[model samples]
Structures are given as C-alpha cells and as structure tokens.
Target: MKRRDFILTAAAASGALALSPVAATAAPMVFTPGVVAKELAAGKTVFLDFKASWCSTCAAQERVIAALKAANPAYEQNISFVDVDWDDYGRHEFTKSLNIPRRSTLVVLKGDQELGRIVAQTGESEIKALMDTALNAATM
Candidate 1:
C-alpha cells in the first residue's frame, strides 16, 4: 500500500473513532452541590436528580425514584442523594455552579468524576441501572 493511502486511511479511522459514542459525548456537569462535592471528595457516590416545578418529567422522575428505592432498600439506604431546586430560589446558584442548561437532569459523581447520565429518557429501569452503576463503581 502507498504511504499516502495508509495515512489517509488512518486519518479516517481516527475520525470515526472520535465520532463514536463514548468519545462523542463526555458527561456534562449539570448539577453538583457542596454536600455532593464533599461526598465525591471522600470517594463516595452521589446519585442526584435536578428538576424544576414546571417540568412534567420531573414529577414522573420522582415516581421512578420512589419505585427504585422501594425495590432496592439497601442501595437506596446507602447512596447519598439530594435534590437541587432548579425551579425557585435556588435556581440561579445551581445553574451557575453546574453550568446546567435546563432541568430534568440526573447526575452521578464521585467527587469530580462523573460516571454516566440519563438525558431525555424516562425508563425507570434504565435510570436505576445508571444509579446503581455509579453506586457500585464508588465501592470499587
């Protein structure tokens, strides 16, 4: 194969890899609080949901939270969880702190590292899986 051809092929392969899923979207720091910051510093896992009053999705997400807790009492009990009020008085502070564009975000972090996130999805099972993965990763 010609050297020039090889170089062109390599460049195309690299570009495609960059466009792949894992490389395409790095996790966004949509929500992070002081308490959550502390937990992460201690290598603890935080599973939090950011929501506002007007978003119907937030209300439904709350139900998912309830069901998740009921199903995994042990995990629910151990995980450090909190809700950021993106609706009212706390809105500006949270949005500024996390550089969040909108509400209805779920963030999982261990200190400064984010494992995964669920965006524009309402599957209860999938959300729990992401939460559990973060919780499980923190322990390891």
Candidate 2:
C-alpha cells in the first residue's frame, strides 16, 4: 500500500476506536409514548435524555453521561435511562407535558415527582450530580 494510504487507514482506524466506547456503552431505551409512565408506575427512577442527533450540546452531554455511567455502574443498575429523540418526539404531548424547553434536556423522575433536571448543560460535574440524584431516588 502507498504511504499516504497507510496513514489514512491508520487515522480512520483510530477514529473508529475512539468512537467505540459510545457504541459499546449500554444504550438507553428509546422513548415510546407510554414507556416513561410505565416505568414510573413500576417504581423505577427514570432518567430522560431529550436529544437530537444533530445537536452538539446533546453529543457533549451524552459523552459526559457515558463517562459517568461507566465510572459508576449503580446509576444504570438503579435507574431507567430513556432516550427521547427530539426529532421524533420533540413536539409530542409527552414532551409538552413535561415542559421540556428544548433538546439537550436531562430529567430524573421518581414516582410522581421530578427529582432533578439539567437543560443544555454538559459539565461533567453537573451531569454526575443529576445522575447521583437519580441514583439516590432509585435506592430510596
């Protein structure tokens, strides 16, 4: 193979590897119309991530969330993480009922109460705190 071709292939391989974590990470359930209500009724803490594929803020928050969950397995073990694709459900009543202002919103709900929320915020600490809240509520 040509030197240039070899370099390009190496770079592409590295890029793919870097993205493997996001792919390999346990994915949250895609939100269906009544999934949230069902989970909440079952006494599970729900972590709702309202995101769009094209949103950079959502991507950032996802990275932070993935890292946090990897660091602490309890978050995933205790909470039900659901991905609400903004493109699909952004205008749906479920979102409107929650008053989600926009994509990149992260909400933690337990029972009939909202435990915590973060909107368009991607700081590691902030995301971790929200996860912690969900964990606490889940274990309570």
Query: Which stretches of model 2 miss by more than 4 angstroms?
Result: 1-24
Query: What overall lDDT goes with each candidate model?
Result: 0.68, 0.93
Q: What tens digits encode model 1's per-residue C-alpha lDDT throughout 76-135?
A: 545667677675524566456666566777777776767777765678887888878876
RMSD of 2: 4.2
Q: What does candidate 2's lDDT look like per residue over 1-140, in tens digits?
A: 99999999999999898777455568899999999999999999999999999999999999899988877778888999999999999999999999999999999999999988999999999999999999989998
Over 4 Å off in model 1, which ranges? 1-33, 89-94
Per-candidate TM-score against the hidden true structure: 0.66, 0.83
Give RMSD to native, each candidate. Answer: 16.2, 4.2
